[model samples]
Target: MRIGLIGAGRIGQVHARSLAADPRVGELAVTDLSPAHASAVAGQVGGRALPTVAELLDSAPDAVVVAAPTDTHAELIIQCCARDVPVFCEKPCVTDQDAAQRLVDQVAASGVPVQVGFQRRFDPGYRRGHQDARSGVLGELRRVHLVTADPAPPPAAYVTVSGGIHRDCQIHDFDVLRWVTGREVVEVFATGANRGADHIGAAGDVDEAAALLTLDDGSIVTMQASRYNGAGYDVRMELAGTEATIAVGLDSQVPLRSVEPAPLGHPERVWSSFLDRFAAAYRAEMAAFLTMVERSDPSPCTVDDARRALLIAEAVAASRRARRPVPVGEPSSSPVGLGSS
Candidate 1:
């Protein structure tokens, strides 16, 4: 299958490598804002770089993976949809709900398939948790707890355009909440702090935050997100119900409760970043995307799914700004996108 990749940045490179390695992919057409970077990545993947999105679309690849900046996603998806090209787009879906909804509408009207990148839903541990939730074994589900923290924050430069924490970091958490419980968030209350670094503050973003999400079925979701952690990148969750609680944990790069450490050459527990923690999910999501493209099936992460999550993030941001709980039904008045990395 011929594949076209948009954006040759870090995440784009990751996807490009995955596509290059897949035997089913016959050709890769790559493009980015930085032509050199696009050429470099395409060369490594044994593909050619296209100078523009128009050209990338003209290449007529069977499917396109958009790992570009948040601001670029909606427009790219719209263009892809217009040409009836299948698109697998990275998340935030424009960093705002209304525009995202419009883009989704356009995609639907165009009769093209578009998948949002919410890779965690494809993670083995998270996938199992979602399956268990659907099985209804956890009777009278009461609480859902999610913990996500990066060992280190991104550079200040990135924070400048990160669309803030809610849109960028907690988005995965927000997406997972819906995927696991199959419930709509009704309301949100949020609080945050900037205790980690001065740059985070200067970037007009918080270092850490927690939010309580009220779901449709009276179940509650508590999400904790942070940009800095001393231990390692942490991603964990538990679903507590009247009957029993199901727990899931991502293996930390760091060791746990070990009196005797490795004899030698032990790597630090610190994950380099989200990439290290969720690489397998990335691969799986791409494989799933390929399958969907091949079979003309609906995306695992639909445009509506992307819309709802962004709306929830907007609601949480609104709550934090208003210093009061906000109803998800009430759209966020604020127009600015999320904060730093």
Candidate 2:
């Protein structure tokens, strides 16, 4: 399987390395607006760099992974599908629900596989939680609380172009909620504030945000996302039900202090290498995508999954914007195009 990569940013580079590492993949090709950036990554993976999207398509790679910036996803995806090149797009399929639906419809009609990069679903911890939820261990689920925070805010430029806090950051939690519960979010009520940093406010984002989401089955999920945290990245959830409650978090990491002096000091758990976790998931997701491309197998993250995740994110953003509860529904009958970046 030959893989071509679009964009040479941090995630693009990660995917490039992961794809190359897969024994199933033969050669890797990469492209970025900045040719130098593309070449640098290509050098690391023993892959050539393409100058344009068309060139990459003309190369006839078995599949293309679109890891470009969020704003450019829709068009590049459409183009890849047009070439009958399967795509593996990163999260937030599109910043807006309407555009995302259109893209989804197009892909569905094409009968080609396009997997969204919600790699968290493949994480072993999350997978265990999902199984427990599905196996009735959480018995008649009542509530799910998700807390996700980045170590620090993104660059001002990225925060500006990113759809917003909900779309840019919290959307992962929204997707995780749906995947774990196996239920659709029917409505959302969200609240946000710009208390963390003045720069975040200037970047058109809230430093802290929370949402109360209701699933169609009367399941309630509480999601909290923060762009600033004093420590390393933290993503955890506690699912409570009538029978029992299960919680998963980044419990242990490096930078530990040991004291065997009978309650003299406490050990500090710090994860110095969080990327290792993500790398495992990335490899799993890529392998799944390759299998789909080879045998036309069902994708791990289908278009419907992407659409639903985006819907929940949009609902949360709308709820925050209007300061009222918002119901999830189909994008307006009037289909729309891309939003201004």
lDDT against the true structure, per candidate, is: 0.85, 0.79
**Taking the tens digit of each residue's C-alpha lDDT, what string does model 1 give over 16-78?**
999998888999999999999999999998999999989989988899999888778888888
lDDT value for model 2: 0.79
Extract clashing residue pairs from model 1.
Answer: 163-338, 163-339, 164-338, 164-339, 164-340, 253-269, 254-269
After superposition, the stretches of candidate 1 with alpha carbons farther than 4 Å from their true spots are: 250-270, 337-341
Error of 1 at 315 (Å): 0.9
Top-lDDT candidate index: 1
Model 2 lDDT, residue 220, Cα = 88
Model 2 over residues 1-341: C-alpha lDDT tens digits?
Answer: 88999999988888888888888889899999999999999999999999988898899999999998877888888888888889999876776666776888999888878999998888878898999999999889999999877767777777777767777778778888888888889989988888766767775568899999898999888988877666556788789999989976634542223455633244264543336435678878878888889898878887778888777777776667677898887342212221211
Could you report the Cα RMSD, in angstroms, for every candidate shown?
3.1, 3.9
